[model samples]
Target: MTTVLWFRRDLRLHDHPALTAALETGPVAPLFVIDPPLVHGRWASPNRTAFLLATLHELDAALRERGARLHIRLGNPTREVPQFAREAGAQRVIVTRDYTPYSRRRDAAVARALEALGIAFHTRRGLLVHEPEEIRNATGKPIAVFTPFYRVWQTLPLRPLHPSPAHIPGAPGLDPGEIPTPASLGLPRPVDALPAAGETAARARLQRFLAGPVCTYAETRDRLDLPGTSRISQDLHLGLLSPVEVVTRARTLGCDTAKFVAEVAWRDFYHHILWHHPRVLHEPFQAAFRSLPWRNAPAHFTAWATGQTGYPLVDAAMRELAATGYLHNRARMVVASFLAKDLLLDWRLGETHFMRHLVDGDVANNDGGWQWAASVGTDAQPYFRIFNPVIQSKKFDPEGAYIRRWVPELRRVPESYLHEPWTMPPSAQEAAHCVIGHDYPPPIVDHTLARQQAITTYERARRASASEPPTQADR
Candidate 1:
């Protein structure tokens, strides 16, 4: 009675409920399907794919340490998973559940296919600390707002952590296939600045962060220049580290851990929102705002994407994302705000761009963050609350350390003019040896004017909606 353990996002061997369940039933055959749609999709980023491949290699090594091996197949999961399960002579397939729209459909199709083949299909909750349906309002409906959701989430209990099995009995005589390279997947070679990938690396990073940084995370998490934040997002995104392990470890570190835990809760909140409302992937979470007029300025978007926006902080953040496949959390908000509020562009465009470049880009979190910045989602920022890039720059990167690092043309500028170089007089620009619009391009859009335009646009949309009658096509 062998069971097939299908690995998707949950890449690690530790604290894996699905793997533990499969091992409990009988000897286990581990399988990973390289779904063609995902490997070749528009959301595909070479950095993320490369990191996943590296993590898979590490997973294989860990599996071999036990008495098992990971079998790899290339095709659609609906077809490939059942075929592989039958070939392995497995009676059941166990997998960790996923909440994305595509994943939900794929899993359903696979489950149906497996059923037709007389195989049992089971799923376990390992992606989040609690299942999406587990935490809801008093009425048993999913909570749409984060504050209330987080409040309810705090009251819920996490499942006890499951330790890795001491031995994983391998399904005998099965061929463990080779993990494909980026080139083999028709993707470009990954950028060099990606963090190391693997369960070992993820565990080490967690230990290091807990040893010191977790204590100051409350005060320093927002600082752009400091290495005060944990860079474990990619690991979590790839499931190299389990959320249970992360939360359980953070809780023991004392009061400062509350803020970090709250951040984790926010991740859960977004997943819950995404689980209940799948349309947020393409439209505004607030239905009334769906038809908000977006300027969709092309040249402005291109400047922002290429890191030539002339606003030092925004430019620095964009350049950092391009050079390395990661951006500081605080910088993410600033750039997102600049794109949506300042340039008056569509938030989806910025979201798509981030997914295209970020190594840790998860759909739920990315869409939620963009919508929050754009004031179009559940628990979103007030429509009138626009971020002033200059103010944010001076507050977070006060000494301009982050700005100077990525925007080298500003290296010679005085500290006074570092954040607002466009305001420098001709004489001051020459004295600093970095002339405005020459050494560094002048500000692409005036912050003052852009903010007003954004407010006006939102107001106009609100009025238009108020005057119109409800229609079935609103959603």
Candidate 2:
């Protein structure tokens, strides 16, 4: 009997555990389900959808080159996988496990469905270095803070990386439909250049980053003007590149490259947190933060969404996201912090917006970043630590080259006034060829007032928490 390989976010053929498992079986049927939840979710964006479709097309092509093809299915995995297995006469299903609550539940339902049909189910663990329950504190509970969680994560042993299988045991009888496009999914067309997909492109990207930028990554990653960071986040999120391969490669480079390796660890760190504390998805990770009075303003959210925030740096980041389906990490932080702290909006709003735009967006990273900015998640930055958009622009993008690249109106402004066009003299503003209120919106909210309000609001929430102590303190 053939084994079924169920592909989700792990799209690539190389360094894939489930794919390896399927090959080890007699014959394999590779499958991907385009579920309604994924299609209609808030995180779904035309840009992301287009990139995903393109990637599937690439993966399908790669499989064809190897005398196999990805079997694309459209329906709930629980309903689809079992049906596909029964139709194809498969005895077992193989898949890379996902830590997100939605994925976990979906997989469980599929597993149960398969078991009832007398089909075996197997899941692989290496999507993350440390599986959620694998790393625990001395007390056997998941760590709630990142620093301690990271420290604990460092000590956990990881599996060795696997090479891509040369031959995928083909389930020759099964045929699949055409891979869906953004239009087929009823999504708008994306207007950005997505990186080429498949194991080949992923490996080449890793090799190129190692040859040059890996050394300076620690220093230049924060500089928005430089192409310092490895632009592999989308690849990793899509599973075109495995975390183990990335970590192993970074270690092979040594010295400063270790920092790049640590960033991979950071990705795992967030995934483990989400797996252990799934509540972080719907509520604050830190209990005291549950009471935050987040402003629920849809119009303000629309402005932030369309990049018309009246703050150049924030607006520029938002515009970049709208145009490119990507934003620099520093820009992500600035825009996220501006939305949550300065704009006093809910972190979920920002999280959804990011998911909609970022080609690199992952459930763990997007949620972790938003919660950190909002000071509501494990190891989150304090809420009082608000970022002033103007100062942040000057500090990170000093030449305003980054701003000028995305925001053409600010191109003629002197570097000194690029971050603060409103500060320019009336004549200087005219000479720069733009009007603050006419060409661009004014600052939506005064930074100073917002900062103080955010601080006070957080402080009050923390202070107002229930003081009742647990009756059974320590077992």
The TM-score leader among the candidates is 1
| lDDT for position 183 in model 2 | 83
Q: Report the C-alpha lDDT of model 2 over 1-475, residue by residue, as the tens digit.
A: 6988888889887778788778775888888899888878857877767777888888888887776788999988889999999977999998998999999899999999999999999998657766777767889987777678778876766677787766665778787877888888888777757667666787798889999899888899999888998888888888888887787777777566867877887898888888877878888887787768989888888888887877888888988888888888888889888888887899998898788877888998889988988888888888789888998998888898888988888889888788878888889889988788887677788899989998998888888765634234111
lDDT by residue for model 1 over 1-475, one digit each (tens)?
8999999989998889999899887899999999887877868888888888888898888999999988999989999999989989999999999999999999999999999999999999888887888888889988888788888888888789999777899998887788999999999877899888899999999899999999999899999989888899988887888999899989977666989988888888898889998999989988668888788579999999989999999999999999899998889888998898888899999999999889999999999999999999989988899989999999999999999999999988889999999888999999888988788999998999999998999988888888888878663
Worst lDDT 10-window in candidate 1: 466-475
The reply for model 2, stretches above 4 Å from the true place, is 466-475
Looking at candidate 1, what is the lDDT of residue 237?
83
Every model: Cα RMSD to truth? 1.2, 2.2
- C-alpha lDDT of all candidate models, in order: 0.90, 0.83
Error of 1 at 249 (Å): 1.1
At residue 402, candidate 2 shows an lDDT of: 87
